[model samples]
Target: MTARGYPKSYALRRGVILRAAVHTTMLASEPALGGFLAWDGTDYVLNNADGTYAAITFDGSDIVGVFFDAESSYNPYVSGGAYDIEIFFRGMPPRLRSLAERHALAYNRQNYQCRSMALITAAFWSVDDYLTAAFPWEDVFRHGAHIVRVELLGDTDEAWQEWREAYQCSPGQLAAARALFWRDLSK
Candidate 1:
């Protein structure tokens, strides 16, 4: 049985299936269902030992939101060091279900891009790092700021303060870092 805070009634009506993100990952034991991931009972950390798991969040015939996590998420960008993934659009009408699902998938694509910096060249740590690296992601971050409302952040703010307090800035280094840090990242 799917646990509480989970969907108990879902029969794949109209090819729309809602996946739940249960910490226990008991959903994996069910037949034909794909793998999954869930929080560790001890902490919010996604436990590797127990394998991927999640529980459905509805019961009976009610059509609630689908609860899901990295394992069940079709987004390829998710499993890549994205520790924080919370996409919720509840209380929407059933007619908009398709649109809601699509938005949920894309709600955090920019977030994934932000986290991907950690995996890229070791030189890129924060805005300071990007400045030091000749300001990569210039176009993406710039477009993000200039066009849409996107918050590009990492350790840049804190690093800026630290740099202000700890050491004097060279004109070139400061300018380069500042340009990428202040301008390119945020509009």
Candidate 2:
């Protein structure tokens, strides 16, 4: 099979910085923000950004992975800026998104403890693991990352219970999943 994503010729220059097309427009236009970034062979320099940078692993020109510190705020929501702070791998092979969505659906359907929108969302985000391994560096070049938070809380208890039964989700499982979701968000 042919390798996908960024070609084998892209190189990370130490002092080079590129303007990131941040999906959040509010965070992209601030001049005093942390958009200015530089690669230090380990992590990115925030360059006045409000948050920390995640460690990016590159194999020659291909991005093998991104390592976020457990305690560091590497996500754009926590970080006030967007440029160089957020990286989305859209060119991570065809059907990667669909595959991840399928995986999430299957996982929730099979695991009672993971039957929640939160876990599904997490699964979608975690799809980057597969993308990094299979496609590499494509997140940086291609753009198609869109995240929508849909809170489908039924209007009534009976409705909610019916929906849960239809989806085969247990109340305890949903509670645990919600806890996990909050934990990740609070982190």
Candidate 3:
């Protein structure tokens, strides 16, 4: 079940351009890389919907995650750099990652899950007037946001499949999901 292996150890070196701990102040100056997901200890660090880092507790159902290190400072991979990228593989709350693994590409959770919610909203477009009120996304979204444990929802394939059917994801969405599916965090 170990998707990828991590470095036995990572030692900080001089002037390492990217991949520093999250606390590095220089991260602000570095060009924005796409969101970074990793471990800052036992907890998991995820890019929140609002452009902030979120730390989620782990459960068995979470998708595989990674932690990269050894850089003198934290620099997101998107910041132009020549250094080799190494990752320490693990997991946390795999909410989005889980969807990606399921090939639900267009289901972005960014910006308060707007993209996902939009898909659900679109599903309503196809709903009959009588069943329109039966759209269940609100319950799903609410449970995801309010529940302290991801296990209550966003924890199984069945839940995601329902959303996938409701949204009627496009080919682009499938591609996106496949692209984001798994983290190859091996050294």
lDDT of each: 0.26, 0.29, 0.26
How high is the lDDT of residue 151 in model 1? 11
- List the lowest-lDDT window of 10 residues for candidate 1: 117-126
Query: Which candidate number would show the highest lDDT if scored against the true structure?
Result: 2
In model 3, where do residues sit more than 4 Å from their true spots? 1-33, 36-42, 51-53, 57-151, 154-158, 161-187
| RMSD (CA, Å), each prediction | 22.8, 20.8, 21.1
State the local distance difference test value for candidate 3.
0.26
lDDT tens string, model 3, 37-119?
44433334444344223233223332222222212222233333432222211221245344323432233222222323211
Point out the higher-scoring one by lDDT: 2 or 3: 2
Candidate 2, run of 10 with poorest lDDT: 143-152
Per-residue lDDT of candidate 1, residues 26-137 (tens digit)? 2333432232232222111111222221111112232222222233332334444443322232223443344323322222223345453111110111111111112233
TM-score ranking from best to worst?
A: 2, 3, 1
- lDDT of model 2, residue 44: 32
Ordered from best to worst lDDT, the candidate numbers read 2, 3, 1
